[model samples]
Target: MSTKELINNIDSFVSTDVWSPLDPYKDEKIIFQKGDGAYIWDINGKRYVDFINGKGSILLGHNDSDINQLLIESISNKSSTVTGPHQYIVALSEIILRDLKRDHYKIAYFSTGTEAVKASVNMVRMASKKSIILSSGYHGWDPLWYHDNGPHELNKNDILDVFFVPDLLKRAITNNKGNIAAFVISPDYVYLSEKTYNELFSICREHEIYIICDDVKQGYRYRSGNSLEMVGERADLYVFAKGLSNGNRLSCVVGPEQVMEFSRDFTYTSYYELLPYISALGTLKKMRNQNGYMQIRNIGATFLNNLREILKNSPIDMNVNGNGNLFQFVFPNDEIEEKFYRLCLLNGLLFFNGDNQCPNLAITNEVYDFVLKVITQVIEQLSSNYNTGSFSINDERRFISAWRQMDGASDFIDTSDRLIIINKLFSE
Candidate 1:
């Protein structure tokens, strides 16, 4: 069937119009058929560079040969699932522990980052004997961590929200003292500073509240280990997913034995699935052998630097946020952001518009250059339209409206100066 027909059929039965927050463009959605490396093909056989990268879950990029082979082997061996623990799980656990450099820390498996986060929160609550959790950044879709305006009604008193400001965090801690169980942080290193994280960690430590580092999105991209190690701080619990098994369904919550022992009470049937274990093992081994993390970091750095330089001279007033491997474009107005999104889509570049652009290991220098070229063209076209006084004020507002309704839309503000200064100090 054609793309439109398939979409129509999906609309007939699918409960929602879009699957995830990353899928914002409902009216102009591209029905992707297949992906290889950094690119994906639509039902019409058109190719586009995929910067979304499975919403940052694809560590080695789509259809990685080693990961594919390992998956095939596991399936052929009829070891994809078993009644009990298996060798693949043990091997993968060993590698994870070694990378963490903390042998005493225990791990509990889950199928998604959301589940891992939920498990971590539950463990912390049980261990600390407190119900209140002060959180920052996006944790997951679970109602326990959702904002006050989330789709479902929230308890309002359970999970309190705070920004990166030290004073704000301190006040929240002071007000909720003794009742606070844990401070859950899903660090967005782009806007967050190591100093701030250290201060927050120190506060949580002082109050004896467990620190749960929700590294679901940022994990495995910056380095092989957890974000705590990278930032020179530690957490009582760590949640990892996304890039765990490239694109396979796997997530893990790791912590000291004292806290992780609570996970046994929350057993899941599919937690011990064998294919994801094998996939994670292969992905981690390949990443270490090839030094893939450094390469991804370098690629991201180059792309961000070059893009920043290009944007500096453009007539458009777009701001760029994030590090080398993961970043985003912040537009001054919704109209221009919408225009840029549609233009890039029209020109065979699929950026995670209104969110992050997750560059993968498969995005080589050449691919990045092509992506930059397309972005430049899009910017130039946008500038030309504005210069000629032909820019559309009547452009459809649905996409931008949907994006604003999402949780991270608060980041759309112009904080270029603060972000640049923080990033500069961070690099040094």
Candidate 2:
């Protein structure tokens, strides 16, 4: 069938797909036909360089040869989901632990990121015996701590509602002063992080709070280990996904053995076992190949440097944010950013941020070059538009005020909407 037919026949995979929502990220509406190394073709046969990477899951690209072969072998064995230990799973788990360099990186398999997340949350909360879960919205959706403080931004995903970071979670953790459950955080700054992680970890440690780092988005493509590598092996719980199976349905939460033991008491689950093996084998093999890490990091560095060159040459104000395989290119004004998003779409690039404020993980040398070139063209065209004059700090502040009212921040908030405030001063 054509890409259109594929979209028409989509399973939607929402309520039935492990905590997935009906139309999360609004991507369900887009028709995708086939995916190659770093590009996906729509039913219309219009190939677009994919930056989403299944939301950064497919680090090695869609349908990688190695992963696909393992998948076929695993599927043929009819051992997709089993009750007992399997060589594939054990190998995977062992490889995963070994790769993370946590001699005690004891892992329990989960079918999806959400399950991994839920399991991690329960483990930490139980171990810590606290209820506060501090984190950005990237962690799988589950009941650990309430994201009710409201400053977090809500986006409609094709499968579920996503509460993203823009709000400060630590403020609440500090203010509440109750025994906190787990402090979950993304290593990257995309979610309300101003490199406050060092202090945040220190505070959580001081309070005896379990510091849970969600390395889902930045798992493999960027660093040697997930950004959690910097945190040392001491975190009470750390969850990893994406790049594990080269993008297959695999995720694991590694924590102190005692903390992970908390999962023994509660047995809620949704994931299949095959994915664990797939993730383990794929990640292990890739890492052992040795050059994978430097290849991705170098590719990413090249891509970033090119972006900086583009921004320097462009008349528009733009900057790249975050780092390594998971960075986002930020434009000066939301309108231009939004316009560039559409423009990128027109140029056959699938940018994630519809608002143009954030475009992440272009992936691969060719795709990255294509995306940078397109961005260069867009900036050149928009730069000459006097009406598109670079936005200033004051202008950004005004935009934030208006955006807050428009986004319903006037009504409620969870942590301080500091991202909104901080983003305002970050101009072109």
Candidate 3:
């Protein structure tokens, strides 16, 4: 079908245009047809290097052969989902525990990262007998920690108190001491300084608060051995999803037996469909054998280092954020950045979502070289325009603020209700 036909069909059945705001151009959205390795093809047969990488879930690349083979083999063998329990689930749990280098922790499964977060919230509140939660970063759309408060802020009466710095955490804990059950955080992709993390660890421990590490985004990419290890601390409960199964719909919570036992009666998801578990087993096995984590880090570092070197002599002010696995480009001005995005797209590169690049293990030298060439070309054009004073900002439509935590353009745009805020800011 044509793009218009596909849009019409979708509009007929789809109730919500939930992803409308993520369109970089704020115009037509491309319908992806297929993905292989580090690239994807849209319905129009146009190909683009998939730097978003399934929003950081496709760590091994799209349609990875080993994972696909496992799924195919399982489906062919009629691996039916049993109602009560399954060996594959147990095996996935075992692999998680083994890879995380933790023993004596029980594991529970769910179908999505949000479900896993919900489960973590339930587990902590029950275990600690507290009703309040303190959180930082995005922990999925579960109502426990998130409130629909006009996009920029959380509800004032929310049971969850969010903080960006360690001092705020300390203050919040002091103000709501006995009611706070857990401190939830996700720093696998974002920046959480070691000092701040240690303080969070120290404060939570002193107050008898459980620290829930929401590792849904970082999980396997951060490392097979506990993501918290990189920050020099561990949490009471770690919720994992995304890259765990390389695009499989599976998530799990791993914690001590005492903490996880509260979830015995809380098990409420039919995620034991078996296919995702099998995929998880295969993906984890392959990641271990190949040291995929280090490989991704190396790839990201190499790309960023080369990018820095290439732009060193250029007049454009640029900076890079994130670690070796996931990073974003920061341009000197919003106009330049916007034009750069358009130029990249016009030149057959999909530099959308503000140049956030999440490289997977499949990013070969050739693939990265192509990416570098595109970027260099764009940068050269941007530099020429900058020198000539020809670059003009056209549209200022920004990405939705809710996607700020995951999106790279977040730094360049406001997260609040823009219209309301602008009206309020400059009211005559």
Candidate 4:
């Protein structure tokens, strides 16, 4: 069947169209066929350079030969999935602990980052015997942690929200006082500083509140281990997923003996799955051997620097935020941002519009050069249309709202203090 027919069939049965909500093209959606490295092809045989990278889960890139081989071998050996615990789980845990330098921490397996975050939140609450959870950054879509109009009514008393700003965080802590059980922070290196992190850590530590580092999205992308280690501070518990298994269904919560012991009360059948464990083992081993983390960082840094250089003399007042591995474009307004997004899609460049772009290790030099060329062209077009007063906002093509809803971009608190810091760091 054709792409249109397939989409029609899907629309007939699928209750929600989750994938194409942010796709600017309202007429037709691009149905992806296959992906290898930093590129994906639609069913129509059109190719696009994919910067989304499975929403930052494709660490080593899509269809990695080594990871594929490992899965095949495991399945052929009759060891892919079993009814009980397996050796791969133990081995992967050892490697994870050693890499994180947290030898005292134990691991609990889960299928998704959301599951891991939920498990971590429950563990912290149970261990502390406190109901309040002061949280910052995205922690999955579970109703227990996520609510569109703020904390859900049931969880309002349980989850209090805060921003990365030190003063804001301090106020939340003071307001909640001894009621706060733990401060769950999902670090965004782009919006926060090491000094701020240390301050937050100290504040929570002083009040005897447990710290749960929700490193689900920014975990392996930023560094080899979790974001906690990169900031020179440790958390009471760490939640890791996304790139953990390089696009496979795997997530894990790791913490010390006392904190992790609470996990015994939370168990599920699929937690014993062995395929994801094997995938994690292979992905981790390959990353270490090839220095994949550093390579990714370098690629992202180089791309950002080059893009900045290209945009330096442009007419548009645009800025890029975050580090090499993860960054986003801060357009002057919604119209310009949507224009850029539409142009990029037209040019066969898939960026995470209105969200962060996660560059992976599989992006070759050729891919980088091609992406830069497309971006340069897109910028030039945007500049001409914007400067010539020909830029008109398409009312029917609105995508920022959908993007914000899909990725929770609007959920973040972008304080003026944080903006000043980001501007200073990325200033030309």
lDDT of 1 by residue, 1-428 (tens): 87778888887879864545435466676777899999989889999998888889988989998889988887888776656788887888887777787758988888899888988988888887888887776777777764554321224648876545455568878887788888888876665557778888888888888888888888887888786677798887888998688988999999999889888877678767788888888888888898988899888789889999998888887767767677777776767887888888888888776777888888898998998899999999989888524333221222233233223212333334333433443355
Q: Which residue runs of candidate 3 sit more than 4 Å off their true CA positions?
A: 18-22, 147-157, 188-190, 387-403, 406-428
Off by over 4 Å in 1: 17-24, 149-157, 387-428
TM-score of each: 0.88, 0.76, 0.86, 0.88
**Candidate 2 lDDT tens digits, 203-295:** 667777776777776566556556655534346667787767766667778876878777664333434456556755775576557566667
TM-score of 1: 0.88
**Which is better, 1 or 4, measured by lDDT?**
1
Candidate 4 Cα outliers beyond 4 Å, as residue runs = 147-157, 388-428
Q: What is the C-alpha RMSD of each candidate to the true structure, in Å?
A: 6.1, 6.7, 5.0, 5.5
The order of the candidates by lDDT, greatest first, is: 1, 4, 3, 2
Give the per-residue Cα lDDT of candidate 1 at 75: 81
For candidate 1, list the clashing residue pairs, or say none. 300-324, 301-324
Off by over 4 Å in 2: 1-29, 77-81, 103-105, 143-146, 149-175, 189-195, 231-234, 265-272, 354-364, 384-386, 393-428
TM-score ranking from best to worst?
4, 1, 3, 2
Worst ten in a row by lDDT for model 2: 154-163
Range of the 10 consecutive residues with the lowest summed lDDT in candidate 3? 394-403
Span of 10 residues, lowest total lDDT, candidate 4: 402-411
Worst 10-residue stretch by lDDT in candidate 1? 393-402
Best by lDDT: 1
